[model samples]
Target chain A: MKGSSPLVRPGAPGRAGGPDTTRQAGHRATGTGSRRAARSERLAPYVLVAPAVLIILGLRLYPLILGVNFSFTGDGDRNGMVVGLDNYLELADDPLFRTALGNVGLLVLLLPVAVAIPGLLATFIYLRVPGHRVFRSVYFFPAVLSPVIVGSIFNLMLAFDGPLNTVLGTIGIGPVDWLGDPGVTMFTVVGVHVWATFGMALVVFLAGFSTLDSSLLDAAQMDGASLARTIWHVVIPSLSRTIAFVLVTTMIGMLTSMFGLLYVMTSGGPEGSTYLPEYYIWIQQGQMNRPALASAASTVLFLIMLVVGLAQVGLLRRAGRQD
Target chain B: MKQRTLWSAVLVAGLTVSGCGSATRTAPSPAGSGTSSKLVVWDWKSGDATAASYIEKAKADFAKKHPDVTVEFVAQPFDQYYTLLGTAIQSSTGPDVMLFNGGGQLRDRVDALLPIDEYVAEDRQRLAGWDAFSKDGKVYAAPVTLQGHPIYYNKEVYEKAGLDPAKPPATWDELMTDCAAVKKAGKSCFALGNKEGFGIQFFLSGLGSGVLTPQEYDDWIAGKRDWTSPHVKQIFTLWKDVNDKGYNNPGANSTAMFNDSWAIFQSGKAANVIGLMSDIGHWKDFGEFLPPDKIGVMPAPVVTDGATPSLAYDGGIGYGVAKWTKDPKLAADLVRSLTSTEALTAFYAKAGAIASDTTIDASQSGPAAGAIVSAIKGGKPALHVALSSKTLDLMGRVSQKLLSGSLTVDKAMDQMAAADKAS
Candidate 1:
């Protein structure tokens, strides 16, 4: 194995230099000076990443550690105290925490539907259809608005005497209780969430579509591939990375970004139907005066993100290996 | 040497900025030289506008008297006012005298407020219900207005439903019967939107106090009694009964207090509304749906066989002196001025709310204000504000669950007990 290493070293010099004196010079340089070069080269990756590493450690990791430490305590009265794992133990019996978990699961299941509709909508715009820019701008307008603004607008629109009911009246359809009914409140919030976020997903898919080689699409068309077939077989495979990226981001956004909408719209009510874990954490901290419970809830949220992120990283790594 | 020069230049720049800040410390008032150091007074009531004009008059009057004190009046939107005040007071940079919501939350921040015992003692009888403004016998706030939540009904709806327009419901059964009739006549009878839950508490507690004694209420608040008791269960059952009877708007659970359900009542789609004293000024516009003679006011209903009917009473806003204010006496003067009968009378004229002072007779108030005062004075006891914070949250949650069919009265009561225990 030691003798064969010399042959492997020759491949690098042979590729870089012509097979004469240049090759000898390359070999000489590698044999003599490569050790020092390799040491710096190995450290170069870490040197480039140092700032980001420090930032993550300082901002993200430190807070996460502090939150976990707080979660173990029964510090509901004071800001914090050390009780040692009692908070996590309490979670086993916490009905609200369980409800929050179930709601988060529901949110996760609905996220793909939320992401896909916008993804396809953007794909249509990317195909250069008539009034595509106008369509894109209109579809993306809600994304530009703050969640509070969007929520308030939806609250007005869904109100009993709102314009929506007026339109329903014109159609001779009875009014649907969009926000009042517990069963429908989640769906209404989900609708608002999709409206508010789908634009960013659309734009991402459009960018992904733009990066695809047009010749491959042309080849697929020459082979009599239908649009659906082209999308499923070629386009989707080419955009798998983008799809993965959008999926992870959409999940994270849904888990964390619904607080403003929940606050302004239903306030997680008509019986906590629209209550997500994030809003629950806020309620625990602000209303319940249970910062320890909130910290525990936050720790659970952190674990969820960590698991989901690690899984995504693993999947991406496998995909890369396959490629 | 170059590094030292660079450091010296940076130091000089910092010194220049700091020097400029110090130079402006003694700057004259922007309003003018005659204008004294501006004393800001913050409040959230619409009456603030009338109060502003009153303050302008007071400023001229006070200037003629003192000639050195200047007052600047600042009013903020009601929703943002408390948060802005809280933050400002915490930072030691709030208005000299500002309005605070009178309740436990303000009581929690006692350290941030200056005790107004001296101010109260100077004119004790002029300040009505001084006990309510006192914390441990030391007054921290001066009450400005008395907000009584009265049940106002559209007389046209009553007449259309074949009920007497002159005689409004005085008992729970009468109210329910009239409501059923109103609903049958193709209009929502009562506008009870519990989506915010505060409105629910207002309605329930208003009626509940008539049935549940003050002792029972105290027992509930103190965790000695469960909500499943007949008295407490009646409140929840009444909510369910009203909802089941379709007396309320169909979308009330989703409707916000100020936005949908209340707006419906205002538009005459709903016949009856529980309105605040402040809402009396808007009655003229609300009465456009019904003739002025067809609108009538009454206290919130009492249960059958109950001794007294009750209305929810929110002690409107109170003026407080910030603890860190440079001029406590000036702040106290501002508070005293705002709460004075002259200023309050002008406020009452504009807003149609009763002045807090008992010396300002109800007979002198407008018809609407008199009605509000009568309803409040007739009330048994306001149950909602009397409950502890923990019990209030329990009530809000249990009421929500009961309405949604997720909790029965017994289960809700148990949950309330559990919540009390947990707290």
Candidate 2:
């Protein structure tokens, strides 16, 4: 009936059509509206990401760039003229820098073993072992105390006339100078570092364990899998992500957090045996008036962290793929 | 999503705004007019009870003199003092006057200090030891206090150890013999805590002055003289001798100077303390421990066999007006007033400090002050102030190593030579 009504008018050769033109205009309007909507949709994710990107650029990237630039320049005195890689070259030959790097390397190598003990404890607790709650809390208590307090307390405990020596005397063992001897100083510092930090790692491990699939565990148990086998094949693999996170973060913390302990306990002495990179940096910048050297050392540290981080990311991605 | 975007924008804006605000706040600005009502002073040591009284008196006196001005005193703790001073000076929020120790540390910060030579020139005769204030021919700090480290012993402990209480050691050999007697008496001979490594300096400097000529000492400091030479070896040997003889506290290597040594000496478990200006008052309860008459003060024993050269360690504390101070003239005036004889005498009497002014009558000093004055006048260098901080810190570590038996005299001397060369 509508077609019959419209059929009365036929257009001349050059005249414009009505219904067809109307349909085309409607399509154009709808296309423009959809394009606007699509543009906003594309922008929404970027708008969400912009603040984070800006923050990273400001706090991390900018300081890193500035540090790198300052490292190549002369010491920040009135005569702080740019000297182009002199500081880095000096760092290459610097004995103190070598010592600092060696100490930091030692810390990194020792940290994983140190952290594993706490990780095992957490795993035990996560499996609902007897008295798990009390054990977990007991293990995690150290993490709540500040490093300075821990260091001071340890200083008193390990002092020459303190309880440690008294215990040794009673055991018919000779007195040992825990902090004074070069051989024992690093071990002392590392022991304190592990004690102060292991709790946080345990907490992370527990959190990771809670997310594991109980169904998989039960299935493994039904198949007559042993406890060790279930942990090895099921639990550890599930918590690989968390383990990587803790490993990198703890390594960074160990490199930096020794300052408070060293300052409180040794002041980097009994012959600079406990001097780490951060403490060395403090001496350079604050005590020695050698900020250029400190900056150079800082640059080396940045590079080390960068390499370690990249390696960690690569390993984690490969592990993720395997999973 | 729109609400999230708005909130995120607000957060970013907040951070940026705060950052800008702090940046602006931290930047330096020019001084206000002289007619300003308030004056600020920063001091670390002078905030102690005795020093506070003197400061209060000075404030009252200054206020009475200048009715238009109000004085404010801020005492920063020793640990945070330098940091706050550095930041404040850099930002021009510094006090009109600041207390400083005259040493290499002060020399390093010489650029931050305002030269007071002009003020001193106007009141030249009023100053004492004018050279103490000068750095690079410009007086930047005004001397306030003189310090010295003397060996103080418990006379009863000496008598108990079969050494004469009235006659302290006159030579290094005699001192060693006395130390042995004290040790044999089942008492700690000396309170030598190397944790802070300050005790090491006192020992080294005392020995070094006796053994090395002034020229030789200068050459050694300048790295021109070999630290592996006989003089250096002798100094370390003396240290080793003392350590090996059980003269020092048994656990000296691990003992903290501030915490452990004070307790040891106060408890009369130790015979002697090579104590600074502060240690005299530490024995305020002298009657309970040793009786007032039993506390004997003498020069740190000399190494030279004959009459002991009047050897002592003199450390000076002073005031410097920050370069960034808004009121330079007022700061200079404050420094002048603080260093004046009238001000210093009162400060010394009140604070138990040895007067830095050589012109001041030593007879006028209290018993403790008299000892410090005599020590300084007799030609002693405050080894802590004489050597650079790095050198001092190295000495500290080496001394610890020496006590621990990890570093022999030969090895320590070699290390010192190497360190001196490096520095």
Task: Give me the candidate number with maximum lDDT.
Answer: 2
Q: What DockQ, between 0 and 1, does each candidate earn?
A: 0.23, 0.23
- State model 2's lDDT: 0.70
Give the per-residue lDDT digits (tens) of candidate 1, residues B290-354. 44555567765777464455555656567888786676776687677676677676666655556
Clashing pairs in 1: none
- Whole-model lDDT per candidate: 0.69, 0.70
Residue A298 miss distance in model 2 (angstroms)? 1.0
Tens digit of per-residue lDDT, candidate 1, span A1-323? 34444645556545434434543667776544555554555555567667877866765566557667877778634545678778777775776677778888898789779878877787778777899989988987889999999999998899766789889989999887788777788888988989898889888988888888889889999999998998788878888877877887787678767888989988878776667777777777666657787778777776776687788788677766665
lDDT of 2 at A300: 73
Candidate 1 chain A: worst-modelled 10 consecutive residues by lDDT: A14-23
Among all windows of 10 consecutive residues in model 2 chain B, the one with the lowest summed lDDT is B1-10
Query: Which DockQ value does candidate 2 get?
Result: 0.23
lDDT of 2 by residue, B245-343 (tens): 777887777788776776677677889886665324333323345555667776656664443354444436888887866667776776766766666
